[model samples]
Target: MQKTFSEKILAKYSGKSHVVPGEIVEVIPDIAMSHDNTAAISKTFAKIGVDKLYNPDIHLVVLDHCVPPANEAFAQNHKDIREFVKKHGIKKFYDINNGICHQVMAENGHCLPGTIMTGSDSHSTTYGAFGAFGTGVTRSETAVIMATGKIWFRVPETMRINITGEFQDGVYVKDLALGIIGKIRADGALYMAVEFTGPAAGKFTVSERMTLCNLAVEMGAKVGYVPPDEVIFNYLEGRAAAEYEPVYSDEGCNYDAVVDMNLSELEPVVACPHTVDNVKPVTEVAGETIEQVFVGTCNNSRLDDLAILAHVLKGRHIDSSTRLVVIPASSKVMIDAMRLGYIETIVSAGGTLATPGCGPCMGNHLGVPATGEKTISTANRNFKGRMGNRESEVFLASPHTCAVSAVTGKISDPREIPVDMALIFSELRKATLSPVLMTR
Candidate 1:
């Protein structure tokens, strides 16, 4: 049967030859991930009366959200998670030193093409960049997956997003993602599976591809995917586990909707104030003063991302009025940036490099903005109070824009400055370092 990339993978995991949209199937996911919220998931697991995990090895837990624990309550939560891991012999566990759950999975080898993985975090869709079918589930739902290794899903209809044209200098994948989300609106693809294709998609590296799928949830998608190809294959060759089959969409497969985007016309767009869909070209809002500029998050904090910032900030410092904060997505990414000297470049340019974790992006830890202040960040969300005080504003944009704006203390257009494409590409190439090996 003809099927989209997601449908094909779902069918394979459900033990079927074919599956249709809206069909409910029981799928045994290749991996189930949880983070600091694992404490809550553990509670649900107990309430469900499950004494042992269906397969402890398939379960991954990472402590990140409030790393080091903000206070006593959070400290106890981490303690509960550690106890759970110890008692259950969960071998895939990662402590605070690891970083964001999504990045940990990708940097390691847990998320691979042709496999379906679900996490309790919304950005679980980030794994789709590696050609895996990734979706977010509730903590309770995660508990069930831990207990049974199986979860039911309604095969979502597919949305084909085809792009043709090359990005102009100074524009990055983060800009493209924000543009797509803005055009599609917040709920545009509700419960649908989005598949990226076309010349533009082909131009993206595995890291850039992650930005596309990472924001799929912003469009209300159940999951997002990119078909496996040589680019992704090369990325996974040494990093991904060797046991899974690769999956892709058939040529004649059906799609519920098709959106064609011309990349050449895309600009440095930002999601303003209170919504991911409230986007406008930076040109439309330039000169809007900002108090802080953040350049890392699960959606944009890979090694490549930090390298881009370093390249942009080389021999330059941010505006004295703006506080620049940088958080590496994971310790693996952080170590790589340091080895490449990108960390030094960033710090020398006045960017504060925080530990590997989701710092300040969720307003739960460091770098939270003050009331009435404004921040420009690479994070996926821009809702009120998302990054600190409710009165403060958050604007989402590409790392290039975020860095350049940090220099100006305002919403700035990245295109206003000449970009050294050669330098950026060199950094991007160096960014694909091998994942750090962790002992089981």
Candidate 2:
């Protein structure tokens, strides 16, 4: 029987000849990840009454949220997570100094194609960039996996999205993602897996693909997949830990729906305050005043993203009225940005750099705006109160758009800024292609 990529992977892991959507199966995960939330997961693990982990190697604990601890309680949470890691002899632990868990996982060779991995964070779907069957689960489900190294899934039907054509100057992968989510509606793919295919999808770099898959959850997708090919293989070279069986959807596999998109028709887009699907082309919101601009997050903090922004701000300074805060997704990304002088370029342009973690992105502490203020961010999600004060608003856009807005002190279209495409592409090409820093 022909099977979709999700079905094929689940069937292989579950030892079944065939599995269909709506069917539940017990399968072992290649990796089970948690972060500062591990404290909560540990409570569930304790409730499960398990003294030892099913497989210490497969369990990963990262410290990202509330990094450097916001308060005594947050500090205690990390303390408890450390104790849990030590108690179970878990070797895949990453402390606060490591940066975001999703970024760390990908950079450290834990995410590979054709593997099943789940985490307690919604953005765990970030692994799908490498063609992994990745998804997020509740703490209870994660605890069950902690005790047994196994979890259950109701195999989802697949929705195929085929994209073609080249992205015009000033537009990027983030715009494409927001465009798709807006068109599909917030819950269009509820409980389904989305497969991205076609020329445009293939043209994207691994980091660009990560930006797309990371936002899949916002579309109500259970998971999003980009089939592993030369791009993935190239990124994983000397990085992937174990031999992987490459998998793809069969030619005749069933799909619940198939959507075709032409990248050439797209314009830089953004999601207005209070919703991820309330998207509009940049021209629609041009000149909207903004008090701040943010240019980093798990979704858009990659080297290519920083390089693009740096190219735009080479000799210009950001608007004095609009504050700009830049955070690298991981320490390694931070180091790369510095080595390439992108860090200096941005800083010299009046951008403030935050530590390498999820700061301000979740409204935790850094760069919080005043009530009623507005911000344009490269991070996914723009729900009210997501970036502090409920009255303050966030407009989500591509890094290119954010850079231009930071310079203008208002939401602005990148098309208004003159850019040398040849120089921008050259700088982008200099970014490391390896998904994981093989040597660092």
Candidate 3:
């Protein structure tokens, strides 16, 4: 039988370097991540007659969820994780202060192209941002790989999503992801690998592209990828670059599905409460007063994202009815934002800046929306009770949208904001068009 392109990439990474279905690949994981939510899984591994961890160096544990643990049970879980990391000599323990595991891992170069990765959290798929074949597993499964240096994957069919057209001002990667998800549905790409390609994706910065691929599992995808280009190499080079070849899908690779997106006429999008796939243009729900607006998290905490927000809210103050909270993804991001005057600008404009960490979004550490309140955020999930109050409603949007929401006290469309978004986009285009053309 003729081998498919995806099969070829997996084959090279497989222990034997050959194409075979249902065969467990044994490649080394470039990175592994876990959080307090899955801390119990680490205990389960110990109970299964596993005394020592597989690869202490490769294991990365985060203390995100249960930050100030909601209750005794959650607090104990974090405590257990701490003891385990200490006992195993795990050197990569990021306490609650380290921000979100996914952001920290990628920004710090823990995951890179062609590397295999696993994490206990379902969002582990976020590492696909680095062009790695990454996914989630049970804590025990993760532990076994930590020891055995291998894991299994059921070869999945591939889907190629080509995004084209120019983007409207104020729209961002988050909007594109929501647009894609709305079209594809929660299970639209079920049991498949989604490979985003073409001009639009190429226009995105590495972090923006990462934000898109990180949500692969939201549509039931097994994995998501972007072919390694200069953006990928630049982010990887001089950080964690190595002398190794990466396998790419053949030029004529077979695709189980194909989606063509033309975002030229697109507007900022929002995912309504309780479902990421329930996407609608921001205009549809704008002006509905909001109680809280959160900006930060592993999914949308890049400097570029913050810069965009700063530009949007440079002279505006939060709406009297809305409380805006900004949490950087890491200590580094916070420090840099402060050094660049973004932090001061945000604070003086009535935004409360938090330390570098994942709490507001996690619902365990930072501000929790009051019951029945409405919230807007730049975080990944907008599922029920995702950010603390079960009765509260959460809408997902880009940092630009979230920032404007803070000022308007409602879900906002960036294009409608007082900011000069059109000029912003025009200048952005001129400044970036040259480099993109050069690269091509």
**Candidate 1 residue pairs in backbone clash:** none
Which residue runs of candidate 1 sit more than 4 Å off their true CA positions?
428-440
Question: Candidate 3, which ten residues in sequence have the lowest lDDT sum?
Answer: 431-440
Candidate 3 yields a Cα-based lDDT of: 0.74
Which lDDT values do the candidates have, in the order given? 0.85, 0.87, 0.74
Candidate 3, after superposition: displacement of residue 58 in Å?
A: 2.7
Q: List model 2 lDDT by residue over 1-440, tens digit each.
A: 78999999999999999898999999999999989889899899889887888888888998988778888998999999999999889999999887888888888888899999999989888889899999998888889998998899999989999999888888888999999999998998899999999877877777888999999999999898998888878777788867787889999889999988898989999899889999999999999999999998889987777877898899999998999999888888888788789899999999999887888888887788898899999999888899878989999999889999999998999987757756655655555632321110
Cα RMSD, model 1: 3.1
Per-residue CA lDDT of candidate 1, range 238-337, in tens?
7775577888899989999999988888878889989999999889999999999998888998876777788878889999999999998888788889
What local lDDT does model 3 show for residue 70?
63
TM-score of each: 0.96, 0.96, 0.89
| Clashing pairs counted in every model | 0, 0, 3
TM-score of 3: 0.89
Model 3 Cα lDDT, one tens digit per residue, 247-318? 567777667789998878667889998999999988899888899888887778766566567776788788
Show model 2 residue runs off by greater than 4 Å: 428-440
- What's the ranking of the predictions by lDDT, best on top? 2, 1, 3
